[model samples]
Target: MITNFLHDNYKNITRVSILDAKKVFYPMKYVLEKRDILIDDDSALIILPFPEDIKYPSNTKMTDAGMLWDYKVEISINNQSALTENQLMRFLNKKVIVVFHHNDGKIIFGCNEMPLQYGYSEDNSVNPAAHCGYSVECRGNSYYSKVST
Candidate 1:
């Protein structure tokens, strides 16, 4: 049995409300879909799964206000399609909010107040046959919390 549920649909995240970051404002309340992580149950929010390489040894610095953190995530989207490429372009030089849903019902949120800045990097190929698409890197602050769902 094929496990790629989005192989046929091939959708991408074009909106922030896909995961509803508002509901997860606090640590206790949250949401997730681990069993069907890539399943776009809502027609309003068609999302695809991309592997994220979160830079380790996360650095936390002390600031005048309080503590501050810096994070970097490398997302590899493989080859979704040309249409997907167009949609992904909109993220460049933009503030992107990401809700990383874990298998054990936990979510790593790209800070709601200070969303991450996104841009493209290390594009594998331009040749249509071998084109893998952009390797997006999002850098900013983040917080972790348990998923309420």
Candidate 2:
């Protein structure tokens, strides 16, 4: 179903590893540009789900590269109380599905599982919501080998 959604909506999606932080922003940037979503607010981060199958580069020292991990996601709007931790966690815990709807009533779903790793305030301060960023780490097994039809 997710695969169908992505195939019907988005043009294409590039899979990037979480360890590859340098390229991680590319998909985010692409989604923002295509959706015309403004990154000025924390809501932008909420629109997209965290990616899965994050592995370190071959040269990295970490041996357990294929293990699956969880992530914490936070979406800060103008008001910090707009969304509570429980609510945020629930949203992030939802199935990793992204459906891109076009004006023509056609939909394309991203054929990828976007799992959240973790979340918290960037400044380490608890206050009104300022920015929404995720603290994601790998979890479980890698799904990179799973093929799609």
Candidate 3:
């Protein structure tokens, strides 16, 4: 099977700073050869969404590979942070991903020949507690007929 096995080639891995509201991060690493995601290896991007954290997938569009689904994840430190205003503002424009919680089984976006693209946001804001955060939306397009995990 073909895979993107180039070591340390992901550019998105360089945008981590503080924690979100739930102490998790986004846009974890995707190892092609392993067919698995590296959530907590060298980064703090383990976004295990809670049952209520799973939001709706919006902005449907057709892709050459398959259907592209956009997922919005609200990440805010709010009252759970210690970063300065400028430091907290760095979370914007960073890549993110779509997350979900499944007890029956685990779900993986995209497929063998194709992987999801990192998502970004248009707007970000700070809370009353002087924390910065925004809604990051990522897209996943499957190559096959279904979104196989």
Best-fitting candidate, measured by TM-score?
Answer: 1
Model 2 Cα lDDT, one tens digit per residue, 1-149: 12123432333323221221221232422332233211222222333322231222212122332223222222222223435444445434223322222334322221123333323332233554533433332222112212222
Q: What lDDT would each prediction earn against the true structure?
A: 0.44, 0.28, 0.34
Can you tell me which runs of candidate 3 are displaced by over 4 Å? 1-35, 47-50, 75-78, 83-92, 98-101, 108-149
Q: Estimate the Cα RMSD of every predicted model relative to the unseen true structure.
A: 9.5, 13.1, 10.9
Judge candidate 3 against the unseen true structure and give its global Cα lDDT, from 0 to 1: 0.34
Q: Name model 2 segments beyond 4 Å from true.
A: 1-76, 89-115, 122-142, 146-148
Q: Among all windows of ten consecutive residues in candidate 1, which has the lowest summed lDDT?
A: 28-37
Which residue pairs clash within candidate 3? none
As a whole number from 0 to 100, the lDDT of residue 110 in candidate 1 is: 50
Residue 123 error, candidate 2, Å = 6.2
Q: After superposition, how far is residue 16 of candidate 1 from its true place, in Å?
A: 12
The sequence of per-residue lDDT tens digits that candidate 1 reaches over residues 1-149 is 00122422212322222232332342212212222222233421223444333322246776554445576655565655777676666555766545444332323435346666777664676587774655666677643323322
Deviation of model 3 at 136, angstroms: 5.3
Give one digit per residue, the lDDT tens place, for model 3 in 18-83: 222123322212322224333342333444333333343445567664445553334332232334
